[model samples]
Target: MAIPPGFLDELRNRVSVSEIVGKRVKLVKKGREHSGLCPFHNE
Candidate 1:
C-alpha cells in the first residue's frame, strides 16, 4: 500500500520517528538523525 506524501509529512510533523523506534530499540541522536545497532541482525 502506498501512503500519500502529505499524510506522511503530517504524521512526521506530529511524531518523532526516533521516539517511536526507541520504544523497541535504544537510539542515539547523531546530527539530525538517530542511530542504533540493529537488533534483528545485531549490526
Candidate 2:
C-alpha cells in the first residue's frame, strides 16, 4: 500500500502534464502553463 521513496518524483519526471491532460481536454500553451475551458464549469 505504501509507495517507495522518490517514486512519485521519478514517475512525474518520466511523464508530462500536457500528455496526461491532453487526453481528456483541449489544451493551449500560455507562457509556462497550459489552459483550457473547463467542461464541468465551462469557465
* Candidate 1 structure quality by residue, lDDT tens digits, 1-43: 9988699889989998888889999998899888988979966
Q: Write out the backbone clash pairs for model 2.
A: none
Off by over 4 Å in 1: none
Clashing pairs in 1: none
| Each prediction's whole-model lDDT (CA) | 0.88, 0.89
Cα lDDT for residue 7, model 1?
A: 100
The TM-score values for the models, in the order shown, are 0.70, 0.64
Whole-model alpha-carbon lDDT for candidate 2: 0.89
User: What lDDT tens digits, residue by residue, belong to model 2 across residues 6-39?
Assistant: 9999999999978888898999999999998786
